[model samples]
Target chain A: MLSCKEVTHLLSEAQDRKLSLTESMQLKLHLMVCKGCTNFSAQMDFLRRACRGYLTRDTPRDDD
Target chain B: MTSDSPSSPRVTPETLAALRTDMLRFATLQLRDPHLAEDMVQDTMLTALNKADQFAGRASVKTWVFTILRNNIIDAIKLRARTVSASAYTAEGESLDAAFDTLFKDNAHWSPATRPVAWGDPEDALQDQQFWTVFEACMAHLPTNTARVFMMREVLELSSREICEDLSISMSNCHVILHRARNALRTCLQGNWFTASGCATC
Candidate 1:
């Protein structure tokens, strides 16, 4: 199993590129057993979605 | 003055005003330079106005405007990269490297503070006005090129190779910067928003 540190790095990397099959398998297997990494993955996903909202969502004008 | 598509939302002066305000805020957050962000938003709106007749209503007017602003952001990022290589930008930051090393043990297990807290509904938690205030603060804390590379990859959903081309960095360099960016942003956010209330959030 990948260490939690390595798995967290992979979780962040997975957002930007396609991990190879071996790498993907290793990450998945680790996340299946690691709650911290799993929560981190969810957190990263949420950040991405929040950014998407930031770009396109309408804002109420009149404040700094 | 244009013809009758009842389903298509009209783009009015007030609408553009609101959009310009939004685009400025969004651009400022990503670029973190209020002047440059202002310039980009100005350019985007000018282009939108010049090309208004060409908006075929395929997407909402806001979406159309945002797409333009997004491209504007990409151009600005590329321009900055040409002005300075991102690798050199990272060269002086030994602390970032040390920061990464400190996260793991000799066996590469996570150290205590680096462990992920079970954050709340990220989607909803981030939407809270106070939480977004903190989020922007964390984003503002990133190193310059690291922030650029990170937002391009994670926020704008650009591919790593695209980031490489844009930032004039190699693939591995892009990965390294992104790794640092994520760690720094996560650590900052965890300190501000996650720890005090656990997953209860801001």
Candidate 2:
């Protein structure tokens, strides 16, 4: 089983590149059983979406 | 004036100037040099004005202008990379091993206090102004180069290969920096926003 730490690293890496088949399988298996890793994966997705959204969103003016 | 589609948005100097503050902030964050950021934003404004006739309404004015700024920032980063040693771009004072050590156990599981918790339905939070504040704070908390690389990859939408080549880092090093950045930002947001007891404001 992939450890949560390893799973998180792979989760981050998955953003930049495609995971190998064995690595993907291992990640899927671990995520199925690990709620924490599952939540972490979801948050990573949210972060990416939020970053892209940042470009279009209006930031309040800072007069300072 | 040449005949133009009525749907095209008019690009005014005032409109572009209004967006300057945000553009400068974005440039400054990515470049980490106020003067260079100012120069890039100024150049972007000039280019946008010169190309005002080309503006189409398919995207919002903000999006179009930002696209120009993104290109300028990328060029500036590449130029700096060529002029400066690659070591100067390294994430100073940030140790990825130490960061992981704090978040994981000796056995490689998440440490009890650092385990991830559910942050329900973050989509709606994207519309919340307070949420963006927390998000920006989390981004600002990242190590200098990590934030730069993350913005390049996530905001500027640069490929990892382009980033590696621009910063003169190996592919694996770029991955490590990006991974560390995500971890840091995730933990920061969890603590400051989702898990905080008080108001969502950072």
Candidate 3:
């Protein structure tokens, strides 16, 4: 099982899709058994999606 | 508006305007002050003109302007730091560390109203005015040096080596500052912008 610390870094990496397949599997396995981490992972995934959106958008204007 | 001068390369009117707009945004992101940002942009233009020979045509004109603007930002940060009270710095350090621990370690404890957005449509959320306000606020809360590193590395998208040279900090310190900056921004955005309600926050 991945410790909370490992999962934390994984979550950060998962956003950037920097995790390897093996690490992803391990993270998935750990999350299945850890409710708190499962929720945490879900939240990170959500944030990654949102921030990616921001990155893709045009340079924000001052008026907006 | 002329780059035709014998000593100074004529900077086209169009090129100057583009440079001004880009520098204004880049500098404003660092200082959060429009007036100061404009000044930095102007200074960058002046530098670029005076040292036109240094423009090896290596980096794009925009990148060159950004480099100068970032240097100005670091100088501004150092100036501000010098004036800040020691106690104020200490309090910021202590308080921000506690905030980082709380926000990054756990999410379930956060109120539902502040939960992460479902993130189904990032484009829609990106269009929201509230996002910029929250993003800027979270960025503003970071320690000065940390904020500078983050802006240069992430927002300005400069290389770590370039950031170190620009800020006059070591590579390790750049990593450390970037690490702390990312953590602090992540935590602040979560606590302040992610509305537990997970709705379109204005």
Model 3: how far residue B133 lies from native, Å: 2.7
Misplaced by over 4 Å in model 3 are A10-64, B1-22, B31-38, B47-93, B103-120, B160-179, B196-202
Question: Each predicted complex: what DockQ?
Answer: 0.65, 0.78, 0.18
- Residue B125's lDDT within candidate 2 is 87
TM-score, cand. 3: 0.55
> Stretches of candidate 2 above 4 Å error?
A61-64, B1-8, B82-96, B197-202
With a 3 Å backbone cut-off (N, CA, C), the pairs that clash in candidate 2 are none
Deviation (Å) of B165 in candidate 1: 1.3
Per-residue lDDT of model 3, residues B57-107, tens digit only? 666666665667667777776565444443443454565555445544353
lDDT of each: 0.76, 0.83, 0.58
**Candidates 1 and 2, the one with greater TM-score:** 2
Of the candidates shown, which would achieve the greatest lDDT relative to the real structure?
Answer: 2
- How do the residues B30-56 of candidate 1 rate in per-residue lDDT, one tens digit apiece? 788899998888888888888888887
Best of the two (1, 2) by DockQ: 2
- Cα error, residue B154 of model 3, in Å, equals 0.8
Question: What local lDDT score does residue B43 receive in model 1, on the 0 to 100 scale?
Answer: 83
lDDT of 2 by residue, B77-98 (tens): 8877544444644535256446
